[model samples]
Target: MPPRDPSALVAEMSRAEKLSLVRGTADPAERATGYLPGIERLDVPPLRLVDGPLGVRAEGERATAFPATLATAAAFDPALAREQGAAMGREAVAHDQHVLLAPGVNVVRVPHCGRNFEYLSEDPVLSGTVGAALVDGIQSEDVIATVKHYVANNQETSRTQVSAAVDERALREVYLPPFRAAVAAGVGSVMTAYNRVNGTYMSDHADLVGGVLKDEWGFDGYVVSDWYGLATTVGAATAGLDLEMPGVPAPGAEDHEGEWPDGIPDAGHAGLFGDPLAAAIDDGRVPSERLDEMARRVLGQMARIGLLDGRERTGELDSQRHRDLAERVAGRGTVLLENDGVLPLADDADVALLGPHVHEAKLGGGGSSETTPFHSVAPDEGLRARADGTVTTARGVPPVPSRSLFDRLPYLDWGRDDEESDRPEPSLDDAVDAAADADVAVVLVRDATTEAEDRDSLALPGRQDELVRAVAAANDRTVVVLRTGGPVETPWRDDVAAVVEQWYPGQADGDALAAVCYGDRDPGGRLPVTFAPADTYPASDARQFPGVDGTAHYDEGVFVGYRHFDAAGLDPTYPFGHGHSYADFAYGGVTADGTDRVTVPVENTSDRPGREVVQAYVEPPTVEGVDRPDRVFAGASPVELAAGERREVTVSLDDLAVRRYDPDGGWTVDAGTYGIAVGRSARDDRASVAVDR
Candidate 1:
């Protein structure tokens, strides 16, 4: 094959060549392979790609592993996520991959969302910030990073057909921000979602793909279809979806064996080279210039990434640095949701671990987000290694249907011989009785695995809530550690002596959890989403969620999570940005320069070293036609402080800082005095200052 200009090659190619260019070829070793018979004459070697947002996931070959997206968000360190991306990019280059289909930026809206492990957090700002950083890191290593599931792909169940009927405000505020941020960060490619936004499929949605992504956001990258996500090649191609992944074979071609036949369709059916492109050209559905432009963009990305410069390597696939990053991210992403001085157990303290989650640690979720971890560490093993006393782990409660009060009652036996209403009487008495002899009981609670995304309700699943309540009733010094990807309703928040939320920390997650509890490390992570009571949920009415017509309407608008709870004047079980540390910290003397700077002194008041994330929120006085949250997170800074150490942190605010997206359209700053509050969590405030905009 000659080294031809990508544009010239695209222009000179027949229908078959164009089809082959977009479809991914299968690995030689795989029995099931996709063969593109249309472009045999092009004589171009097909580029091999694989599934991944974290690492290359081609079977039969080992690849470097990185922490899951959720784990990276827990780090609260953009630099670290970016470094992980760079490592993944190097691995991609080593594998001779043209694109890395990853950096899943979908927001973690609900706890039971099956794909939550693959995503970052419920907060758009957090997800976007980390996603942008990762994109920068991946591209830096001279490999293309594909930011994916373009819009409103929070859940996995019925994802292909589900219609995300979100309001404009919610769409802009929650669902779309991450992609916008990723585009701004210069990701090389964007993959459209499998579901529909409103009523239009993402691949064929002109407004989303062409209008918002390409025009408004100024994204110059190529758009690819999620595998088999495109209904028709013409519709997708015309809608700015540049590639049809896993190319369909032509009709009657004996050499090819797979889905999509070989041979051009009859004149009426619009053959690959015939009608769609030709008709598209005639009706102005697609201009030749658009095709030329797409080819240029692809070629340009290749050149900029040094893919055309022969800089790719095969040895960079699994480096030590990549493995180290995976461990670091996994360690940092673990969150200590609650603790009452019981944590960081003394080396000599006797510990009793309980719960099914202890032995079967759910690291990451199912589907595209799943990664073959380099190694997995069980919490029981991790804790046993450091404990001086015998670490006795008891299966307190068997795997039951209910994890919380909100789960469907009268558990149906779907996997049983008969569909009997055999609801196992909520029993924690036996588990509590067993814990009577132990000094400290560590109860582990596991969330649902890959079956569904987002919870039917805010409550925890199964009788786990009942179990927690009973165990807490029996044992006063009980600690509950929740292993879930998203926020679960915690009615038993006040009962448990201590709590820790490990958001599906990938692979080495068990070790990270054990390390935090054993004082091997301090917990510095915070919640990315607000945990509201079931009654206070925006879609509190059962009929309001998932809608009647199979379309979920985002009636909450600009107010989501803490935004909705705060605006509605409702209290949450745990507010966003809420996380506790073993040591105490104080915020004093917060002053914002009338212009663009705010300086505050953060003092570690406790007698121990710890890290504190200082959050700044702005509350604009009521304004007409503004559906803005009273308190919006404007700035956040993480500080490491020693005992009694005071550090002065300065935060800058500009026009964008106080600006809110007007309900009508565009962004506008209200001409009123705004309240600037500094806090450890959304509900927990320390000091307030007035700022005039």
Candidate 2:
């Protein structure tokens, strides 16, 4: 049968019917109660939508649970991410849901932001590439994938009202890239954020929703406001916002009476039934033809996603295929920061595991991003399972007392209260004593929670730096595993024998960590953001973030992360893309043809099989008037090579790479020498050719 024409459907509807189409009905029970008063009854049933980005999160029986977005991101495999999305799609179908609200694409701006783990990475390319893969995967199952928190939702505290006071360049370069990528990848819907961008609420920002997203980016999807994110109906509707989420009562209702309040002033309420839409139709504020066009896009997406045809199954949830992919990704995303030959621990070596995070695994970060897992493996259990020799563990820190990094460190808790809890705290003397007897000491220090939204300082949370120093001093072969959701100040970098940064690996994190430690899996992941020393940025100096007036100014502009460090000639503790493997890899055969592409040869010199992410950094020629520094021109494919295997990876540059943003929002490629470097991480690389534009 042919699909219902959206224009015909809209033309046939009354004002109430039009209103009903925009408001979502909660469930079958709610649908039958005439809860959506504006919707006119038709032969066709109302579509059902579910809450999510992680998985189908409706409170019901037999709903398949998947890993959180952070956990999935830690896997760092696009195929694995796609499989996760497909699984969510299948579950959404089972639950009779038309839209799956997910794949939150917010950038991880600060280490302490509450919901940092829910996003992919700090790098726009990494986040966008991964998000696009996931979006494609979900939509492949014929389910609508709604990309969320539209722009600049970097923090959770006061998120509904806080203004992300970023400049136009930073906003375009950092905050908006991922959403643009998702839109380009064919996402069905876009969810407006609760927060404001600059001085305007996301739902009411005509420049963002109307000017940029729709007109500039050529996004054809309907924009829906975050649940209650809309403060004014008139402003939102005029800004090209198509839907109000979670279904709010019509204009001027009193105390759940489901009727307009008596003597309610027009207050723009006269335009409630899209009278503005009708007036806009008459006066050309909005063309009547455009309304049909918008409606058509919505219905077209609905039909494309199988919502109109009824729910369809694409794949089974939590199948062996998905589990295998999950395990592979979990292993791949682990980054081995440092190794001092103590790792690949000899089967006969005695291993003493110390730290609060050892037995009590800190898998995922807190917030709506949390997931109910089928199971989670712990480090001690994984270590014990693999060890042929003895493995002893001592409770070094308590999980509850202080969740910050300082609280878990031995000397940092000297004068704190609440000393009488069941949670054990290892003293400096005790930790030293334990290390004296052990051949190797593994200290699992966790710095997961940071000051959400607003961080007072960039200092390491607790006595973790002290604990790491003390433990490393006591034992020659000490391995420090720093588990955190974002970057931390690692001042004692030179002291520790080995340091591994495990960014909030999800439920199966323990197993993933163990896999990297035991050399069962090589750490292929790299730092997506730069790790600077404590008190680096201007925000750190002010001792306030998101500011008092609910606005955060990005004074750093384009110089974010490594870009800042490189341009300013400052050294970070760990530069972006800094990760080490047990095996050695070499980069050579660097060749670039000035205009389109660069190719590099990657050789695996070690005896073990591994993958190397060949990052290509570009330094565009200086323009007389352009004030911006160098940008990442191109990056090569992630080369997965076996022992003694060599492969050539080619990187292609686009017009955006060489383009410099003008003051008036235009991009121009300056004619100059561009440096092309290839390496495992940003800090460790070999450069060869320079492209002259």
Candidate 3:
């Protein structure tokens, strides 16, 4: 039989069995990260969820670690994003995980957020475009794709308690678009954020989860709470949160100090979903029909992912093909922020690789996104293989110790044993000595930010600024390779000869870095988020950032990221979509096909084949009863062309791009001429065209 209707299956299930299906399993073996016990009587198999907005988070399973989602967004290619998801999905299947909690669609509201590396971009259009593609790719491979941290889960500090007091218009335009895109892409699950929204916890929000998502948007997928994110049982079920994760870790004695003891939480407790939920159901507080709906959604997804049919596959896990995909993402995502004609290191040039990260791959940021790759390519190893010149190495600074809980876990430390853990921190004199004689000095710097915490400042952490300045002083040709999760202010930016933002490149970090540094590949990425001074960011207000009295007021409204800086008539250190290319390109003409379609001619003026991201931004005019950002990222398209190649890049704007949302009314388009700029980055507008609606 071709699997009975999920509705009929739920109808056949007893109330207790249905209740079990809605919550995480209590069995030790089944509950790693995601789990649900199946009734043997009903022939339902346990569903397994795995962590991966980067890659599989299985402790011992050596899966492929691709670049962070931010990196994929930097590529500005939804097709590449799809490939990234497909690769991760294949790896998830190999690990026997039905649901891959991935493609975190949370908008990068503030640069200080520790988890921004895992997110896509500040622009809702860009984030949604890439996120939707990722969802489609993962689901194509019979894996359940979860678009997570639903609505305004921006900052990590006080994340569990802070209420994001956002207006309805900002929520619709800025934060919620990515999740809407994910739902439109047919994602199987949506994970509620830890924080509350407008004084209501997302897990218990009736208007959002029940009214908007379930009814208004017609999202049929189940809603799962973040680990330990379930606040109340009756409220959650009635509000449409289908699953409570890890079941409120054993109450009496704190079994372990960290979140995941032994790389997996002991899920043997049923604190919230057991007696509390059963009593609520028995007393008729939560309707039985609602329980049946939850069971149906879960079973429906299980059927969709082929979990009920015992889905199995082989030969796709950790394959060479997957590695190539990872390298491509890393290479393309590497943004050349600044250059002074010193890059594309000559084969004969002598190089001094100075920094702690040069010999180690800062594969991904700390937290749930961290993964132990099957094999990680160190920067030194990659440089040695690619460079024909003499390559000397030095640890310029002490390794930034792990403040992240995931980095301290024993399982992640398994493959890190071979690294120089106890090596003495090299003095500044030692680093200067190494760089003094080299033709070029490449310094790899990083930031130690993780989930549940935010960076203290945008400045490079510790004595890294001093280290970079000293090295740059010693050698005029100093190149700084930043492996950070998000934007960091560069105090020594002028001192360095060149700067590259690699955004925590994955397992093939070494190979990817080498390819971009040595001219084997061009830095094809543009900034998805703005690199601004710490004080200039709109969220710089003390009350806005870490929040005041456990509430983050979105007082700046829709002016976020580049939009904020633009509205303030201020310039950023590096504007959103800003990146330098080795090859030059000239813009020719701009034309509008329709209200939504735009075409711009771009011709590569350089001899080398290069990739270009043509960005389309709209300057919406002020209208009655509406608010608009100075400029909004309407649409963007990535194109690869050979030397002297000419092409017309066309970008089509969706309804969300040109429309403004109102509380009393739905999305409305203004009846005026909108100025469209075709450019390389948000700051580099080459051509402009106006179209009257």
Candidate 4:
């Protein structure tokens, strides 16, 4: 039989059945990240939600691990991101998952955020545009797509309890755009953040969750809580949170990682939604209608995806097509930060691979997004396979100590027993010797980041900086490849021959780097976030970031990333969207259709073909008593051009480009001349035009 109407099904179910649909439990199959058992009488199959953003991460199973979400954002191509999303959705179905907990839409407000690699960008326009496309593609396969961390989840420090004290103007302008875009794209699920927003917890935030998301935006999707994130049964549900993930902890918590102990509560109390919720409903503390709506939403999704029907829905794992996509995305998203004719090495040049990552692949930053793929290629393996000349390897320094959320505790240590952390220190002298002898030295370095922790500094962790400087001194032909979660300080940039920002490329790391090194593919990625000294970032101080007491203040307001750089007149080491192509592009005939869109003619004037990411920035009209960035990222489009090819490129503007959020007036447009610039990066504007708003 086809699926029955959700409302009709709800009418038939008892209170217990309705409760089952709104709470997560352990999966009997032991494969999914979160599970809800189905009612056999109603013929509703078990609903499973899996963790993925990099790729489908099935528990204790192998899947295709693609590059990090940050890498996808670096490409500045929503179409490519959508393709990746669709592939992930298919893989989820292959693993028998109904929902994919992915495409985290949290804006990269803090540069040192531990999970920066998991997010898209610092700029709302870039994050929203790419995030919406990913959501659309995931849902195309009938797998429910989730856009997460509903409010400001920028930092990992004190995540569960800290309050993000942001004003209304900044909330509407900076933090809310991505979630709004995801809702606009019709995403099926929205996950609440672990932290509090303003003075209220996100799972219990009635103003933002109920008023803004549900009422104002007309969001019809179900809202789920972050694991162990539900505050009060009555408060959260009344505020519009519909589901409690992993509702009840297992019998023995110590036997399982991060699970709440039996009869013990997380933070202060045991789980709130199981028996406690039932008591609340009996006493009228919680209205029965809210519970009915929760059941309806879950059932509606099951019906929409054919989960309630007697049919089969499946996809393939480790498909050749997906593997090819992983390589293509990793290659395209590799940003060439600097190159003085040292890249595209000779096919037979003797290569020296130096760094701790030479042996192990830089899959991704740790935590939920971590995926275990069937196969992964290391940097040395990739170079050896692709190079005709001899490829030598050396460990310049031992791997950096991986930090965890438990690092502050003297007793508790997470994952220390699992991973071998006491390996003998590698020889740094051998790396310098190898660099001196080899024709070209490619030094790969990485920052040890995890979901439970935030980096204290943007400089490369450990003595990797020392190793890079020594290697550069040993051989002037040294190329540094950073496999980090976010931007890092590059003091030796001027000394090195070239620099490549390959942010946590997954299973295809080696192959992608090899291809870019040998000119098999062009470095098509750009910087999604600016690279600068650690002290210069917007949320630099303790009071503004991790917070002094229990609240993180958004003091910078709407000024973030490039907006902050332009407004404060500070020079970044590498501006946002900064990247070099093998071939140069010439811009001409730049035109603006008022504040709506911009178009420009681009010609590949170089002898080789290349990919160009044309960015459109809109300079807002000046108004007294109002502050705005000199230019805001409106929209961007990527174009592939053959040698001597010329074509016209048009980029549509996001509504944010022409409007600003006012405290009293709401969204208001300033009337004056708006300047539009078409360029390769934020600072390198090639052409400009003006329009009256």
TM-score of each: 0.85, 0.85, 0.95, 0.96
State the C-alpha lDDT per candidate: 0.68, 0.66, 0.85, 0.88
**Count of backbone clashes for each model?**
22, 7, 0, 2
Number of the candidate with higher TM-score, 1 or 4: 4
Superposed by TM-score, candidate 1 places the C-alpha of residue 527 at a distance from the truth, in angstroms, of 0.2
User: Clash number for model 4?
Assistant: 2
Candidate structures ordered by lDDT, highest first: 4, 3, 1, 2
Q: Could you tell me how far off, in angstroms, the CA of residue 276 lies in candidate 2 after the best superposition?
A: 11
C-alpha lDDT (0 to 100) for residue 186 of candidate 1:
92
* Candidate 1 off by > 4 Å: 1-5, 8-15, 29-45, 60-68, 94-96, 109-112, 249-285, 314-323, 400-434, 451-454, 457-463, 593-597, 652-657, 663-665
- lDDT-wise, the better of 2 and 4 is 4
Instruction: List the candidate 3 regions with Cα displacement exceeding 4 Å.
Output: 26-31, 248-270, 310-315, 407-419
Whichever of 1 and 4 has more lDDT, that candidate is 4
Location of the lowest summed lDDT over 10 successive residues in candidate 4: 261-270
Best candidate according to lDDT: 4
TM-score of 1: 0.85
Instruction: Give candidate 3's TM-score.
Output: 0.95
Range of the 10 consecutive residues with the lowest summed lDDT in candidate 2: 260-269
